[model samples]
Target: MNTNAEGHLARQQRVGTLIDLFAATVEEHGARPAVSDESVTLTYAELWAKTEQVASGLRAFGVGQGDRVAIHLERGVDLLVAVLAVVRTGSAYVAIDVGYPEQRRVHMVHSARATVVVTDTAAQDSPWDEKLVTTTVGDLTEATADATPVVAPVAAADPASILFTSGTTGRPKGVELTHGGLVNFATNAALPRILPTDRMGQVSSVSFDAFHYELWCAIAAGAEVVVMPSVPELLGRDPRRELKRRGITTMLMPSMAVNHLAKEDRDAFAALRVLCTGGDVILPQACREILDGQFSGEFYNLYGPTEGTTACTAHRVTADLDAAQPVPIGVPLDGCRVHLLDADLQPVPAGGTGQIFIGGAGVARGYLDEPAETAARFVDIPCGSSWGRLYATGDLGRLRPDGLLEFLGRSDQQGKIRGYRVEPFELERTLRNCPLVEDAAVLVHGEGDGKQLAAFVELAEDGAPAAVRAYLSERLPDFLVPATLIKIEQIPATANGKRDNEALREILRDDLHRRERYQKPDSRTERYLADLFEELLGVEQVGTHDDFFALGGHSLLAFRMHRRITRDFGSGLQLQDVIRHSRLADLANALDADPTGRPIRA
Candidate 1:
């Protein structure tokens, strides 16, 4: 670690502030292309001029230092310009994805108390009524066309932006990042590894915090930030083809990179030089596959929360994959410190697992308007080496003998089953190692009194659900084996691209109900019910009276059940018929009714 006082100060002062750093970049890389998409490309000079125009327009709309401007728009060159413009005006930009639900958008608008909104004309119908002043992307473009360029003075500690984390449990919380923190994180922690000539792939939506790293890393390094439009197939297909076409030398997240590398033609990434994979736990298997199969580029495993301004600790993956039970999270970046401590905030031994705490300049101010949560996670550490604030990550991990941190599962995610602590991430990693499994998610199922483990897996090409289940049964202990394995074509993801556990749980609940309906059959209708249940639930054994919910049947599965029953049993079953006769016995009895029989008295 180079801690030379003059060198540290130089690095800090050079990239010390966001607005100043951006202005300096504009001057240095004037005519170079800064951002490019299919529709448009903006050179550094053009981007600077446009950003000034937009900033001037925003200033006219009463947006200034500390004011929040929520930008609800799709991924495009204009969105990049808008964000920079907001920062240039000394206002923090809050990115809200256009695909977010109306209620979520409303909540974010109200939560951030945004003074202005930048969106597109197509997003005009969004539920953003009169709550804040609105400016369309088109409007900003036209309005800023002729405005004079003026650099706004912003301090290092000034709030640069506020990004909302994907709210799985409740409403999304806003994370406020300072310009100093972001610039420091980018220049010292991220940019050193990125080459000036590299063209980096920007895949995540702007709403995600990862985008902040991707966008800034490119501009600060004078690298090309290639904007990949969000397409359904792009999420599911090989990203390397497009990446290679654009000569993408660096990528930020592992999801797309891993998926692309898993393809048969791994030679697509031959030109790639650096790949950073994070956002979720990077399975060792995925890491090995990347190293062996596709990328010969430098690979890093990055870990951090949104409040930490993208990433705090990064580990450069070595060739040794089988040596450790879990990969090390690597050492902290420049100006950052990682501490493992007990409940009382005392430092734990190197080999013992403890809650990981992060301290340093990289840590953000705290969640916007969430003072309680902010205070709870961010605490002053008085007993440590020196005076500084530390954030309780809620993540459990241990420091290796070599001082590298190895991440254990989340403290909250650890559960006791049969007097043994179980980590779902371990199970998920094991399941993904199977050749036939494309992806897997494990969730604890059933009511409290009868809870059991269930797994939902998406099979690889030419793979079957039963084969995946059987394979896992062979590798894992009996208790660890998923009681039920449901296969789907694809795993659904949230707007931010993390696995949608809530959606998966809903599917499991529906499955349990369908299974219950199959078990309690009262008549010969059990036969038809069994067949329909097997086809609908994608499971082999379903009794006549089994409840749909018990079988992990969800609304989509229910609709599929209705269609399959109606198609199989002819017009004898209607959409209402399936709902009315939810159980096998009830449906069979209904089928047994004679058309000529007299109607019973109500």
Candidate 2:
């Protein structure tokens, strides 16, 4: 918790663009393995050559400074090449999620005003192909092999990437990040450094800011980047085996996955040399289990918003750390300043909770094409000796007497579900867009890993909850889709005409009791499954018809439960059985149908 003013200043003094740092790394470690997937491995020199070829292709097609190119490909070598190629062409890259709904993907591309899209999907299959130029990874690498590589002048303040995050206005806001911000993170000494000998795992979806952090940090350090499978798939299998097999030394995971893995397998991180978890509140129990178990590595809790780069602060977990107490978000990263201020924009008294304002080299260049919104969040604030720009993170926090920062949740309607930022207003807006829904309200419920979205909707005529949920599923990502949906006659409101959230919660509580009314387990299989559900989900008196997801079960937890069931019941009970038959009676029936089978190793 000690603030090293001199050290902080020294770390902030280094200035250069990502292009500069990556170029230097390539020269230093040209013979080392730079990036690899299951299919191929590319040395730093080979990666540089491939990047240069792709950059030449983009330049040949008129991509250069001040242009935005959308990269809409899955995570792998091609995705990495496309991003680097776009940056090499001196154009800001816009990442569009391949898994997002067509409407959402189109909105991101059109909203960013991208001049070209680099994707392998055919133009006929892509919805955003109209008007914009389309190219492929194969075309860029093969067609431009003989072309001259572009050498566009790079600057620290130039835009590098634009990442879209969930917004309360029902539209995703594009946060324009600069080369300086990314360089600041790569050069920051406060973080646990990734050595050239370490093999860092890349797991985050390309659309997320964490993807850039995972990729650039390792690239800048000349470390080996091992691109892993999707997060869900990794969690479903035993991660320790895979990590050890791949020789992954450093990685960052969502708090939900961290907690679940920590509990499911105490030796989950035995093979890792450094583990970091954030993006949501870290569960104390998970921290305790990991630190007390087989993880013999550095552990940290990183905190920040997309507007403040990937991470602004970090808390290192030590042997004497008390899991019972709230974990501090720790001190600001080098070159960063965290100010806790009141509503009047004045600094709050020491040890008082206030809105968190972050000022640092990592602060973003503001939202793209929205001057009003940009001015609202990013403002010029007082630094120590001079005035500097600060992003007003709506998150609330307080500095402890020991100088560590404690996160106190958000001051706005936005919430984090399984590490993904979600705004209930966006979900509500999407719900209202459905013809069956007359009106709707969405609220985040539960705590820690059990947190979920619950939606209440008023039907237009003979609308059903299932049909409305299906409608939302087609439009929103799986995480944004509400886990629990209920039909309501009207939205509760107070006398002041404001939506009465407390009343809505009360209704939700009552409805939960009515819908999942307790029914005693009728058979041995049912009783065993019921007890397991209660133990895993921390719910009391789970009924036969009670659904797992409604009872606060998620994919990671489902994987853990699946392992336990397979270990005790039989291997015949596949992981999909738990998801498909989430009800207690239904799962019990599945076990009965396939009673005799081999047991799966835990």
Candidate lDDT (C-alpha), each: 0.70, 0.85
Query: In candidate 1, what are the lDDT values of residues 329-419, reduced to their tens digit?
Result: 7777777777888887888875998888887778989888888888888889864547678787777888788878888856776443321
**Candidate 2 lDDT score at position 457:** 96
Deviation from truth (RMSD, Å), model 2:
2.4
Report how far residue 356 has shifted in candidate 2, in Å.
0.9
Per-candidate total of colliding backbone pairs: 35, 0
Query: RMSD to native for every prediction?
Result: 14.1, 2.4
Q: Where is the poorest 10-residue window by lDDT in model 1?
A: 593-602
* 275 Cα displacement, candidate 2 (Å): 0.9
Per-residue alpha-carbon lDDT of candidate 2 for residues 192-223, written as tens digits (9 for 90 to 100): 88899889898887888888768888987899
Clashes, model 2: 0
